[model samples]
Target: MVEDRRLAVLRAIVEDYVRTEEPVGSRAVVERHGLNVSPATVRNDMAALEEEGLIAQPHTSAGRVPTDKGYRMFVDRLTTLKPMSGAERRAISTFLDGAVDLDDVVQRSVRLLSQLTRQVAVVQYPTLTRSTVRHVELVTLTPTRLLVVLILSTGRVEQRVVELSRSELPDADALAGGGGPEVSAGDEPARVVDAVVADLRPRLLGAVVGKRIAEAGAALADLPAAVPDASRTLVRRVAEVLGEAMSDHHADERIAVGGAANLARYGDSFDSAVRPLLEALEEHVVLLKLLGEATAGGAVTVRIGTEGPYHQLASTSVVATGYGPAEAPATLGIVGPTRMDYPGTMVAVRSVARYVSRILDDA
Candidate 1:
């Protein structure tokens, strides 16, 4: 019972410190929180808490504030993560629902998180390796040139152009456009590209129906020889391009950041916190390190002050979560001072991440 009361006293002190941004006196803790105890009782509990190193007295005589350990205890001991209100949920859904594609989804997510949390928001793009093939589009630019577009379940699209050599084409001379034989329905270059795509598309889509990317790669491997001998070279080139798109680790893995200006609310005196986050935003590697552990599960991670990857931002905290299809997900979260509202920020970050994950799952 004594330890429980001390924890209550610590919780009250942390709450008041976050609100007033001042050292909380025992009288205020007693009167403001209605602890059903006297001022002397609260003072004794405060002394116990301070002795445990959970709360600190910055001055010789003043109310106590929570230390990094205290904040961690508060976060770890929280009984429940309160749900976002109906209005907040609807707003997040509506804002992200309007995104036209993958890039739009990420950008809108970053904006929504920043706006919702009023903190700097970071979101990583969905991984292609985990995404299923959505569609493959082939557009002919000319008799010798064709555009190959690869679409994925994550809403990411990759396009590449291929120029066929005369030696590889069965009817290269007749297939030429412009100064060559007039474009015809029977021999039009676009028709040739379409014929090849018709064969490639179904093989890719069928193999990846359940997110089997490797099977899709294997299905496409034989397409160069699978098609008619006339279009063999073109089919092989397009298949290679699509394979490259699937394995591309760089393009699909990128970070989107927003709301750096929110850091200013911490006050210039806390430049130590604000500046490091600002620099981390520019250096996505640091941001990735901070959010690296926030995998796709529905768990929210709270890294406070020195507990975070970089102790330099000792005055800052990170609340993050993973979003995307469960099989393959990316990270999203916020950065703010340790004094910021933890419960509210954690709720917002998680709420937005769920909505994003749902959107990608359905897409």
Candidate 2:
């Protein structure tokens, strides 16, 4: 019972410190909270908490503040995350449901999180390796030039231009007997591009359905055989261009961040941790790794000050969670000072992540 009462004192201290951004004193705790205890008794509990390294007195006479260890204990011991209000849940769903596509969903989520938590928010794009092809469009620009467009289920599009080796059009006599345009060395490549586009349109690029961009590209390795002998060269070039476009998509994974201005709210209180955090936020790789560390198990993860591997972020805390399918989930989270509203922020992060996952699942 004594240890439990001490923990209650520690919790009171943390709550007051977060609210006022000032060290909490025994008098203030007794006055602001109904602990039903005397000032002297609270003081003794505070002393015990300090002895355990959970609270610290910044100066000789100032009240105590919860240390990083204290915050970790609070988070670990939290039995229930604070629930969002009815208005808050409605607003989140309304805002996210307005998103038209995957990129829009990511952008909207970053903005929503920042607004909800009043903290910097980071949201990663769906991985290309996990997205399937949505559409493939081939447009002829000239007799020897064609544009190949690859659209993915994640709403990412890639385009490339494939130039034929031949200067002269294919022979028209070869295609004379068919319902389509005649094909030969002297005939325009546009004829073949047009015919192939029509054929593939009905098929809906079945060659790439359900497979990742890279896998789809590989499956089309023998595309040349699917076309007439006269169009063999053009088919091969189209496949090659599609493969290159997939390579480009695989190299570009992106993330969105917003609400950096919120960090300035800490002012002098976070002087030690703000500068490096601002710099690290500018780097996508560092942000990705941070979020990656949290969502490794596809659950909500909280990293308090000094818990994050980097020394510079020791004064900041991260509340993050994974969104999307268990097979290929993405990360979303907020970054703030250690003396933050943990319960509220946890609710916001976890709630937003679930909404995002729902959006992706439906898409």
Candidate 3:
């Protein structure tokens, strides 16, 4: 019972400190929270908490504030995740509903997280290797040129241009039909390219549909052999280019960061933690590593102070979670000072992550 009371005292102190950004005294805890105990009892609990290194008096005679270890304890002991308000939920839905594509969804997610958490937000694009192919579109730009668009289940799109030649399209002249007056030089290219797309679309889709990018590329490797002699060379070029596009994963591994200005709210604390964090945000690899290091259980993960490797971020905290289909996970999270509202921030991160997952699932 005594230990429980000390924990309760620590919880009150952490909450009060986060809210007020000041040391929490025993009198203030009793006044603000009806602990059903005298100030003397609370002070004894505070002394015990300080002895345990959970709370500390910064000044010789000041009230106590939570340490990094204390924040970890608070996070671990949190039993219930605070739910976002109805208005907040409505805002998330409304704000995210208009995203037109994966890029827009990522951009909106970063902005929405930053706005909700009042902290810098970082979102990693969906990992393409885990994503299945959605569609393969072959657009006939010209008789010698085709545009290969590789669309993924994650809503990411990659495009590459394949070049064909008269030699590749031995049937080019045949497609022009004896150079009829109606089939001008310019018109002949269009006619042949259209024929190429019509022949390749279904075949290309068959090779890539429902497969991961790398797997789809492997499946497509043999597509040139399947093409009829009429367009073998042209089809071979298209297949080669499509394979290249599928293997391209640079965009999939990217990270988008927003709300660096929010770091300015740290005020004089900027030099201590906010500055390096801003630099790290610019280096997306750092942010990706930060989110990558987050717990992998799809639950909200909080890394407080030096719990993270970057000593420069010792005064900062990270709250993050994974989004997207369970098969293909992506990370999103908020960065803020250790003095943040942990319960509220965790709820916001979890809510946004869930909504992002829903959006991707719907996509």
Candidate 4:
């Protein structure tokens, strides 16, 4: 009973401190919380909590504030997540679902999270490797040039123009019943390129879009051979470009940030907490490392003061989670001072991640 009572006292102190940004005295805790105890009992509990290094007196005669360890205890005590209100969830969905593309989804997520949490928000885009092939379009830009457009399930499109020549493509004169690289009937090259594209589109669509590519190497070995002799070079070059595009992506390092100006709210601790974190946000490497700590499950992680990889910003705290359909999907979260609202911030971070995940996965 004593331990439970002390925990209750600690919880009240943490909540009051976060809300007021001032040291919490025993009388204030008794007045604000329905702990059903006298000020004397609360003071004794506070003393016990301070003995355990959970709360501390900032001045010789001031009220107590929670320590880093205290914040960890407060966060851990949340046995179950606090669900956001229906209106908040609806607001998130309505705002995020309006995104026009994958990039817009990321940008909106960062903005919404920052607005909701009133803290710096960072969102990492899901990598291309996690996306499946949606569609591929081959456009005949010219007799010797083809436009390769690859679409992914994430609503992302990659386009590359591949230059072909008689060396790689069939000679125009050959298609015209002549044997040379010389231009024949104006429409011969166009007809030949279009035919090859028409044939290759179905073949590539049948393949996944990854390193194995528009046609995994093993599946594509016979592709060139399967096509007509005149289209072999065109098929080979188109497949090669797609293979390169599928493997050419890096989102782990790509981050969209917002609400950095919110750090100024730290007031007295602005120099100690806000300044360092603001500078650190510029170095995406640091933000990536912090967000990397967030796990794939919906579990919201809170890394408070010194618990994170960078100890230099000990006054900063991170509340983050991973988003996307993959096992190692990208991450998104908020960064703020330890004195911020933990419960509210955790809910905001988690809600934003879920909606963003839904948008990316269902796109």
Candidate 5:
């Protein structure tokens, strides 16, 4: 366990270093933290911490900066997360209340988190693989054209179009020369489409809808003797959400952010370190993979320096929490730097995660 005075000094050092991006000396620590300790005594404790690999001097004459170990200890033993202000909570509620759809909520969340934390923000769309199919519709357009629509429990929608040739119709006798039946003058095409949909459900229900026509042929064969040469438009708007959920088994739902602009005003090393992280942000899969491992043990996770996947992000850090519906596995938390304002960042991350989980639960 960390002693209270040493922990207080450590917390003071972390907070000061994060704000100034400068090495902290014992005299400065004593003066700023008001620890009631002499500079000599503070120096002795600093030496002890350095010996423990918790802090390090950049050069022979330079003051100290918190090492990854130091930051870890600070996070584990010293930092007290500050709660969001009532005004801040009200603002978050108001902003989220305006969201009309899943996409709207996600976009709003990313922007709100970025603004509040002044850090890069990332948010994964809700996982859909475990979500049940809420509704499915098959619409017939012509003798050869059809449309398939799928809705999920998550309020996501996917659509596909298929074309059928007269030769493929098993019920060729029901049509005029297998050309298919022409609607009467007063008949609504939508009603006929609905009838066709009702007939197709038992055969196609819960089947994996693929991009190729041949993949769907087997299911089509089970249909009420449909025609051949069936072509499909294969519209898949929510394909990304489903594809990620299905294909990225080891991938956690997460967002990668490029908040380098926020750190750009710091020093050259910070700028250099932040650039690669920003560039790496484009690869969403890599970020999600890292978060997957972090949340695997069901704990708030923190990875610093080379401990994380992206070696180019060696100088940066990530602090994330897991959150989701009770039945679903947890999603990831906000990620930022080791030098980040831990108290404030933790509050923002936890707050956003709770709101996101609530939205998913309600959806």
Candidate 6:
């Protein structure tokens, strides 16, 4: 267990350093944190902390600064995040309530998070792989041509078309009457088409169908024994939709970044640190993988300095969390310098994540 006094001292140092962006001295920590401790006693604790590598001095006479380890420990134990204010909750509701669609929700989420945190924001769109099939429709355009459409639980739609030779055309009338009809070399009569439609209805119900035109063609060769060309179109449509949905979800595994301009204010370390981060933002996959870790971990994660893979992010830090329908969590959070205001940023990130999750859940 952490000593209460030590934790208090660490919290004071972190809060003070975050606000002032300067090294913290024991005197300053006591004065600002209102701790009932003498500077000399605090100094002894500071020395111990420095020895433990939780705090460091840039120079012999400089005040101590919290090391990355210090920040990590403080984050792990020293802070209790306050819930978002009513006004903040109202603002989030007001902003996200206006979103018309999934894309709108993502766009507004990034903007709201960035505005609230004053840091770069990253939001990953909801994944669709686990969504259930919603509906499938088959439309016949010609004796040999058909259109198939598939819709999924996630609001994604896909369509495909299938074509077959007229000779292979089953009796559409026979199918329409829910009866199968044998095919011959001659053109199918209207009654046979009706019977064929009637016969195929039972076979198509609730089955996860594929849209292989070749399969349909083979089925067509058997006449009354063959499936409808529309069935082939339906199968093709399902495959096409599933494939497209997966690809779209993969392509959209992105981070909606904001507040990059803030990095320029760092001056000296700006190019070395911010430039590479900006470049990495262009590679959506890498950012997705990074944020994916945070989401999967189900907590507020901090990646500091060189701990992150990209060398350009060495001077930066990322604080991320996953938020969505409790049943289907999605990721959203902020990226900023190691010097960022952790308490306030955490509040903003968690608050926005909750709101985004609510919006997606309702949608």
| Candidate with the greatest lDDT versus the true structure | 3
- How many backbone collisions does model 4 have? 0
Q: Under the 3 Å rule for N, CA and C atoms, how many clashes does model 3 have? A: 0
Using all chains and alpha carbons, the TM-scores for the candidates as numbered come to 0.85, 0.86, 0.89, 0.86, 0.72, 0.71
TM-score for predicted model 2 compared with the true structure: 0.86
Off by over 4 Å in 6: 135-252, 269-271, 294-297, 325-329
- Given candidate 1, what's the lDDT at residue 211? 49
Q: Rank the candidates by lDDT, best first.
A: 3, 4, 2, 1, 6, 5
Best by TM-score: 3
Model 5 TM-score (2 dp): 0.72
Model 5 scores a C-alpha lDDT of 0.61
lDDT by residue (195-219, candidate 2, tens digit) is 6556544443777767776678777
In model 5, state the lDDT of residue 111.
Answer: 80
- What does the lDDT read for residue 92 in candidate 1? 85
Model 4 over residues 226-319: C-alpha lDDT tens digits?
A: 6656667788888778767666763447889999888777777557776778788889898899876554456888899989888888988889
**What TM-score would candidate 3 get against the native?**
0.89
Per-residue lDDT tens digits for candidate 1, residues 67-117, read 999998888888997898788788889899998777899999999889888
- Each prediction's Cα lDDT score? 0.78, 0.79, 0.81, 0.80, 0.61, 0.64
Candidate 2, residue 13: CA error in Å? 1.4
**Candidate 5: tens digits of C-alpha lDDT, residues 240-259:** 22333334332335453534
Name the better of 3 and 4 by lDDT: 3
lDDT at 312 for candidate 6?
A: 57
